[model samples]
Target: MQVISVNVGRPRPNPGKGADLTGIDKRPVNGAVAVVVPGPKGTGEVGLVGDRVYDVKHHGGTDQAVYAYAREDLDSWEADLGRSLGSGAFGENLTTAGVDVNRALIGERWQIGPDVVLEVSSPRIPCGTFQGWLQQQGWIKRFTRAALPGAYLRVIVPGQLRATDPIQILHRPDHEVTVELAFRALTLEPELLPQLSAAEALPEEARKRALRRSSTG
Candidate 1:
């Protein structure tokens, strides 16, 4: 697969979630961008340089560092929604072409460009902020039901990433915990949390959350 666009965001006013500042207003950048592993959530940092998120409690961490969405999926949404959705429209840092991002396995490693290696960590869970940005009623429920939540990634090897850079699969963990599966486990299907244990490479917080759910159930 290839990177179609590299997007970055700046903090801006967003009244949708009752916040004065939000980073959901991302736009595609023309050149290469540096990708690095940031500190944990609430640290006010992100994987891509110049990107930031307002909801510190729920966003911007190593595990959820780089968000990626497929160009194919965006096209599908455009057809369904009857509007054009550009790259970074969903606040993803990477807009990928010809990649089944939602089907990517948890812990799967992709060698982006020549040096950057990104590991799949979790699924992008829709929230009130996202819904408000889209201004669509029932959007959160619709996105969840669609089961096409994009993949969240962690920087395994930091490097510069540019639009049209090649992406190679460097590793695929032997597990059934795909991004779709993880999304379901974290959202619609609590019973599936136990199944996530197979993906031993999941981020500690995600693994702990799944294990806790499994244990509780």
Candidate 2:
């Protein structure tokens, strides 16, 4: 697999969800972009050098430092929406080709280019800001139902990466908690939540939710 484009957010006014600004307007950038581990959540810090999230409470942090989506998935969405969807249109930092991002297991490690290493941590959860950005009615429901929420990654080895960088699957955790499975469990199917406990690399918030569901069940 390879990276189709490296995107960075361009801050824009967001009247939706009461956030003054949103970084959902990501555009492809040329040249190498630094990737680093961000601090905790609620700081708006992301892995990319110039990109950050405005919805601090729900986005960013080390667990969600980078978001990646497959070009194939975007193409599917384009066909469904009858519009052109380019790289970063979904607020993802990396648009990849030949990669089944949703099928990637939590804690899977990928080596991008010759340096950067990122680990799958969670699945991107659609929010009000995303729905507003797309201007599609019931977009949140549509995206959730699709269960192609993409993958959120944490920087394992900080370095530089750019468009067309080859991606190598360095490691795959011995678990079945893929990004799609996590999204389904977190959103529509609470019964699957108990299975997420097998993925120890899941973010603290998601892990706790899974734990709660397991205890209750």
Candidate 3:
């Protein structure tokens, strides 16, 4: 288990959307990482949800960082068949070498480095920013349709992390709701709410957000 990448971006209101957001513009577009300053939203100025800061209502995590690349995917890389870094399919803050992230299931736990411990929260649901980045319409919808997708995590013990840090799986929830399952559950399958509820490790807001999406099934 190793971190394939370390990423964080400033949540400046994307001034340009639809198409302009796709440029390979270095993130921290706001010029600084959102600090842990006191604010009206939560206990601290730094929203400790994901690894990034947003309006709370919009982006509710202090750690936008994610870990991806399950063991099955890693073998491909070792065999020189894996995708390259920065590829759209590898949308994770940290990519593990031999971890099957999608199977890890939301609410699972992992220990990275000497101190960082995180609980899987939900899958990184696609947003308009993602669509703009790839300049593809309905890109997010397509990702959800694929399922077995990227995971979102909540930092339990925040520690300094960097690319190449080893990852250790501490636990996997006794449920089948994986990142991809949650993704499709959030963006596609509304009937899976019972299983999603059983996953039990998902952040409250993410579950609520998922329940609000369209459901034709």
Candidate 4:
């Protein structure tokens, strides 16, 4: 695993579109190389500590050649150019390798630094801000629906992360409720709720959401 790039950020809106249009640079988050967290840093399996940046698909994206987001669709589907299913930019803080991050279930963990271990929380969803980042309309929606279930991670441990460090898949949860499966089942199939309920680590709040949404959609 190689360090794709080191991304730092500040409190800002969506950075760019498809790693091309978002003009915001990801070098300084509120003017610090890193930041401190109360417990852990972020929500997804990979956490953005200092500046709120995203570690998108690993191998690459639809745009350009390869990408910084470590987890790529190569792990799940067939993509020739090595693209992230998410139309993301290159400002991800830590790029990872050797893992289909979309398949990372909740309760999954990764040892980021001596002091930082991250946990998978939820699949990264598309939002309106992504449109602004890419300078196009419906970009976020298309990516979320088409290519992948981009993910976010919460830092379980807090330490320093320099660029070029190796990203290791330290742990994988035993549950089979992958983010991709849940995304499809939650959005397309409600009969899978029983399977979801089988996840021993499924959070109560998220389980409620799943059950409620399944009933309606």
Q: Model 4 over residues 1-217: C-alpha lDDT tens digits? A: 5333456444354444333222223552322234244322232122344433333332111111111344455234226324443312534444456556667675576665445555665555554445565455566655556636545555556566555455666777767887666655555455666556555444454578666755675
* Most accurate candidate by TM-score: 2
Task: Rank by lDDT, highest first.
Answer: 2, 1, 3, 4
Sort the candidates on TM-score, descending order: 2, 1, 3, 4
**RMSD vs true structure, all candidates:** 1.3, 0.8, 6.4, 8.2
Off by over 4 Å in 1: none
Q: Give TM per candidate.
A: 0.96, 0.98, 0.67, 0.62
Candidate 2 lDDT by residue in tens digits, 1-217: 9999999999999846858899999999999999998999999999999999998988899999999999999999999999999999999999999999999999999999999999999999888889899999899999999999999999999999999999999999988999999999999998999999999999888899999989998
Number of clashes in every candidate structure? 0, 0, 24, 30
Better of 1 and 3 by lDDT: 1
On residues 1-217, what C-alpha lDDT tens digit does candidate 1 reach at each position? Answer: 9999999987777746745689988899998899988999888788998897878888888888899999999999999888889999998999999889999999999999989999998899998878988888999999999999999999989989999999999988887789999899889887888899888878787789878877887
Identify the superior model by lDDT, candidate 1 or candidate 4.
Answer: 1
Q: What is the C-alpha lDDT of each candidate?
A: 0.89, 0.95, 0.53, 0.48
Whole-model lDDT, model 1:
0.89
Clashes of 1: 0
lDDT of 2: 0.95
Q: For candidate 1, what is the TM-score?
A: 0.96
Q: Which parts of model 3 are misplaced by more than 4 Å?
A: 10-56, 62-91, 206-217
